[model samples]
Target: MALTGKLEIDVEIKAPPDKFHDMFCNRPHHSQHACNDKIKGCDLHDGDWGTVGSVIFWSYVRDGKAKTLKEVVEAIDSEKNSITFRVLEGDVMKDFKSYVITIQASPKSGGEGSIVHWTMEYEKQHEGIAHPEDALQFAVEISKDIDSHLTQGN
Candidate 1:
């Protein structure tokens, strides 16, 4: 079955989209704080931090055990302030046949603030499996957290 979902959250940022894009795309910076209380280690490989195509490895503690995920950049549009990525390898893959996530940031039309759209697409191993909303929610929450933290200083 094909699965798709999206989440939208408005966050005020002190800096413009350029700065916001840099911070959001920067994997190392994100790796550091990306961890929820359950997360353990996060790492990025290939080129520098946020360059397109770089791979990210994130390990987290769930149910008293460690699990990891590997994802790679699938597309990035700086002019449009959007980035799309897909899971190259990870625990989630065991259940899902395919998974992709995208984030778009656009300056609010005729306004000082900006809007962010997070999208997730996945296919499950079984026809009855649920769409990956929970995974998408994690990304949305962390992204909003970053946006909110940066906005407060502005």
Candidate 2:
């Protein structure tokens, strides 16, 4: 079965997309203990940081155990300030099989405001492995944290 969700948040970034994207995609910059010690590492294997098709590996704690997630860039539109990535291997790989996550930002009408959108699409291996809404809520929380960090002048 297929599952999907969308999350939206308002943010004010001290830096532009290029800067914001680079910092967030890098993972380490925002994965500190205070933010989330669960992450042990995130590496971009191909192309430069924030470029389409770059692979990233994330190590984290899940279910009281350590797990790693591997993902690849599926799409990117700098002009629209969007990037999409698909999970390839790792803990959730067995159950979800595949997942696509996208992040995008649009300039608010006033030019001082901005809206960030986070979307996820996934295919489940079994009939009842994970609830789509649960994943969506987690994604929303992560997005909110990221937005808050940048807007807080971090």
Candidate 3:
């Protein structure tokens, strides 16, 4: 089996695409209010929000255990509504040699909803580590939570 792998998942959300993209680019910390069970909090470590090279720390739960991840904003494309985060330090580093996460929100044609695409690229330290299916599921769940929060006027 290959030690390096990539997972991509696309989910349909009821929220606006620009709003979803702005949340991650400008105010990721606010997601805690909507998906606190999965993502506890996000803190700015360096640089300013919505800028490349900014560092952010994330607290979350995985497999019923709390974990933390520190990452730097690697790239951002406003026209494409995408942001990429390169993992710097965290539990994932223990198992994976490298990890990158990219999220993109594309507005549906002539519709009020959006299709959110989440991609995870990683190289495992060894073959013993399983694929990050849980992480992908978590992202989809969080997207759904945010959609629900927005549609409910919360």
Ten residues in a row with the worst lDDT in model 3? 145-154
Better of 1 and 2 by lDDT: 1
Poorly placed runs, candidate 1 (over 4 Å): 1-15, 34-40, 61-66
Task: Report the Cα RMSD per candidate.
Answer: 3.2, 3.6, 1.3
lDDT of each: 0.67, 0.63, 0.93
Winning candidate number (TM-score): 3
Tens digits of per-residue lDDT for model 1 on 60-121? Answer: 76556678888887888888888887887888888778778777777867777666667777
Q: Pick the candidate with the highest lDDT.
A: 3
Which regions of candidate 3 deviate over 4 angstroms? Answer: none
Better of 1 and 3 by lDDT: 3
Poorly placed runs, candidate 2 (over 4 Å): 1-19, 25-34, 62-65, 109-111
**Which residue pairs in candidate 2 have backbone atoms (N, alpha carbon, C) closer than 3 angstroms, thus clashing?**
none
Candidate with the larger TM-score of 1 and 3:
3
* Residues 39-133 of candidate 2: C-alpha lDDT, one tens digit per residue: 55676666666667787887876446788888887787877777888999998787776777777766656665455666767777777775555
